[model samples]
Target: MNRLAALLLDRRLVAPDLLATGPIPDLRGPVPASWQGLSRTVSVSEGLIALEADLLELGCALSAPLRRRLAELDAWELTIAGRHIVGAMRSKVGGHVDHVPLFRGFPESVPEDAFDFYVRRVFTVLLQEPEQPCVLCGKVATVHPVSPCAHLVCRACWDGSDFSACPICHRRIDPDDPFLLVSAPDAEDDTARDLVPHPRLRLLSLCEDPWAAAEKCVRELLSGQAALRPEDLESVAAFVDTCAPRSARWLPDVIPSREGKATALAALLARAPETLPDLLDRHVDTATDVLRLLNAAMDGDAGLRRARPIAARCPAGSAGRCWTA
Candidate 1:
């Protein structure tokens, strides 16, 4: 057994019956006339395994083990050769190049972002419940086929927006194709019954409650469990504004009195220190005091320290004078 075949068999990525026998076909020649109408070939090489594939040519380097394995299989004809050759070859031989594994075992030849979109938005649709609600607006959806791709979007969401393409996959919609609607009544029923709020709606609710939202944001930032989404930052800012209203203007004095408030302030400073002076000037009577407190809080934290320089750029009237302290 060649090293490549042994590795693939050990990893369970390829079954023994799928192994090709004899010599690896040289694919460096002109395309065959019979294979002219099929998809273009993509080549991938990893260690001792090399594969070249188009619709007609699915060629792989055969190791001794692979050849022996093929010889032993009574069902060899019913394996990868008899199935979808291109896809099977891609799944089997496309792993690493120059010792670096491709994204999630996909070939480096595949466009990462496009393949990700295809897998996540297109392929995963098959696993989705027939009555899955619209991801946006939490509405019961009548699934309409978005064109130029196989992505489905809710009719209400599609009609509500002026989008010429799918919102999720960003694929162009075909106006010529009839809108095929698959009713998702269960999703609507769930929403109508209020059994559970949609994730987007839950986020909206959090944004509406500034204090609670700010606390949640601070906890997320401190834990380092997951990075905050762009929308989370907006919610955090809204919460900060609510707690330290621009007119009230006494942030440093009030924030230190509560642990949660202090942590939230520190998290905000850590996240966008460039906005520090502006935030303090807008919300604090004593911006210098706030700057000092923030600097002290962020003293040993690497992530927060990276933003210290930007915070130091605060204007003279705000934190510039106290920055040196």
Candidate 2:
């Protein structure tokens, strides 16, 4: 079954009546054709994502202003997606378009010469030790390293090639590498299917209003660890964004990282700014954590940039620079 694209709405824009009331009408939009059941998952921060990995297929999905690739869009498309998010934060629909591809899950294109790509895979298989049985023939054979990439080629199965690039990496290797050959034919149909599976599709929630998203992250993010490991930043931000302010009591007693504590409190306080004093008194532990909250508030004053809480990047220890950067 095809999955409809999910929209993650900031709770502030959601009227209290709408949230308190029955099931609301979902904001509808056209989805990308590539977003089939199979696609990479995605993520986003309240802010601060490095453009490339923050948006690339292998990069971090969580970040703000702009995130990574889940679709076939370029930087302009990414910026447009970010602009829509920016507008949603400001509650402005004056000039914004309703439907745009915001997905970071784009399909990839492989080499056209199917057989050449398949046969080239032998170099990848040869990465195993030459002393072991030959990967191609399943028996011990004389294996020699190709010139530049140095991928071992099984002499028993095939001699060499005349291709310009390294078969495994598809990069330009030594032109004279004995493995490069023009005559290498492609694999048969059965073998082709086995090799064609693309990267597993990852589900990245983009402003989807699901309480489950927050609950799923609580066990993993709000751990007793002192400082957030570099990788935890994305998970932490996602948790804070998805969490509801009323559920603040559900927060862990001790949120370890200064960054984590501030993020949680800021996201909570954004919608319920009246509780600012109490949240500050209770959750705001250190001076740095206070600065983190202050930094978010400063950027998003008067609901102008309300998505600031999750946008706050920089790890805990980078105290002085955290506010400025």
Candidate 3:
């Protein structure tokens, strides 16, 4: 298999579910019929209208003030491909790129105060989920992040297994870790803010490798296809090894934690499409969780076991290992 396919084949297949940043549509309306057109693709929903409508409603619900602001903005210019919302921007002076469509525009030229107005407005609407009960548990959403499945689950109710498939589109979650967690507000003081990556963000990051697999899976999902490769199981094992332990204590209990990783491996072994994205999105309490789990798994292995102690004993040695003071 090629490197991309090889990555998928290496892990135990975990089916991807609704784990995208926002709700993307299916085949959108603006398909580039020939090679000359610029086609926009979003991983969330199938098309722009579907994506926009949802956000519009969400924006309105955020606040009457925000709703008024949205009403004042010029009409949007949109491109649709199949059900996917390919592109969106306001038809105004220096239209801004609508990355998530939570706001009308986010142009660099826009004043920070104006941008902050939009930002705060969106958050107000988002924070009002008590009115919109979760699709899974039917409870007010305290910390629900919508999965690709489009089903919202309360953080308290999410089992991390229900979304074992691309809930909305039915793609397998790649076994590569695509997420991280911060225990509390201060945990992220030293981290970068890449993806709304605040310390309190429910799930912090995604796995780099599986994100590639997700790209491929998106094609397969759109085409109604399935895939299985023996190498994927190995990839799952390797992916597990990537988890490094952190110092925080809440690292392991959030989701399937261990079971989530195991489930991905099992899916690879079974060669079935299970929702792996939801599991990958769990929070970690600390880096120590990753290290401890990895350390225990490496115990019986001759190569790793032999090397760990040597490095542990020589804190300042040539080896890359560092002692924990």
Candidate 4:
């Protein structure tokens, strides 16, 4: 039997109408030529039946009672079978016409909205089935989300890892996709915190070099750390200036001015010795103002003179005189 028919029959949603009393066809034997593409299986004793056919043909074959039963249940999957054609019954009309058709008889050019609608209907019906244990840990599921493979997964199985893709189907979860369920905000926050490299040792192990380690340390500190230690800030500034000199300029904007700004500036100057001269030449006025600030914050001229190499590259004019003076 087709997947949809098997699902409905297993759920006991559409059983054979036994009181009608007629010779039920044997589905296990060879079906007639007229029923070539269709498969129908009926069991009067168990009150179970399975039916599969082309979209249009299935509409023409089901009994009035069975059709009425399916309609009452809002079975969009079966109801939408021949809906693309004109004069289709309103009861059978699918909500959206943009999805690709799942049946073999459907035209290849069917719209994407129609295909998506079909897949969604399948999921809707599948969700109604009794909740199954989580595919991963076999634990009782409190919540269900559609996996990339269209299977329903328990929240416990889903939450055990940091995977954005389905463990079963390996399909990536798109947050905006209608077919998938979005995680709750608190759950997402918990997941984020769990994934973050916490504790200095773990963060350090994840980094390949000193620069990366410093970046991780800074990220951890900025993401709601109660206080910033002076040594940590100084280390980050030095690492950025030494390994990524051009990135030094960004520190003034990202690091709060109240948090040891002078110490950071000093580290930047010490580590970015080579790039400092070119940076000063490019932004002579801004560099001069910053140097003046740094000098004023220093204890003596010896510390200020450390920036002399940068000052020598100033433009040869009034700007140059202003910088040297």
Clashing pairs in 1: 1-65, 2-65
Q: Model 2, 255: alpha-carbon shift in Å?
A: 1.0
Q: Give per-residue CA lDDT, model 1, range 231-310, as digits (tens).
A: 44333334443444331222333332222333345444544444455545434455444544455344422223345342
Each model's lDDT: 0.34, 0.38, 0.28, 0.33
> What TM-score do all the candidates reach, one by one?
0.27, 0.32, 0.22, 0.23
User: Which candidate has the top score in lDDT?
Assistant: 2
Which segments of candidate 3 are over 4 A away from where they belong? 1-44, 48-57, 60-132, 146-151, 155-157, 169-171, 174-325
Off by over 4 Å in 2: 1-186, 190-213, 229-231, 299-325
Q: Measure candidate 4: CA RMSD.
A: 25.2
TM-score order of candidates, best first? 2, 1, 4, 3
Per-residue lDDT over 1-325 for candidate 4, one digit per residue giving the tens place of the 0 to 100 score: 2222222222222332221223222222222334234333312211111121122111212222343343332222322322211112111334332222223222212222332332343233333433433434544344354443333456654552566665543457654441355332343331222211111100000111323444544444433334456545444444454445644544433433323344444444554444444444433345544654354224222224344333332223423333354
Candidate 2, residue 237: how far the Cα is off, in Å: 3.2
Judging by TM-score against the true structure, name the best candidate.
2
Candidate 3 — what's its lDDT? 0.28
lDDT tens per residue, model 3, 65-86: 2222222322221221111111
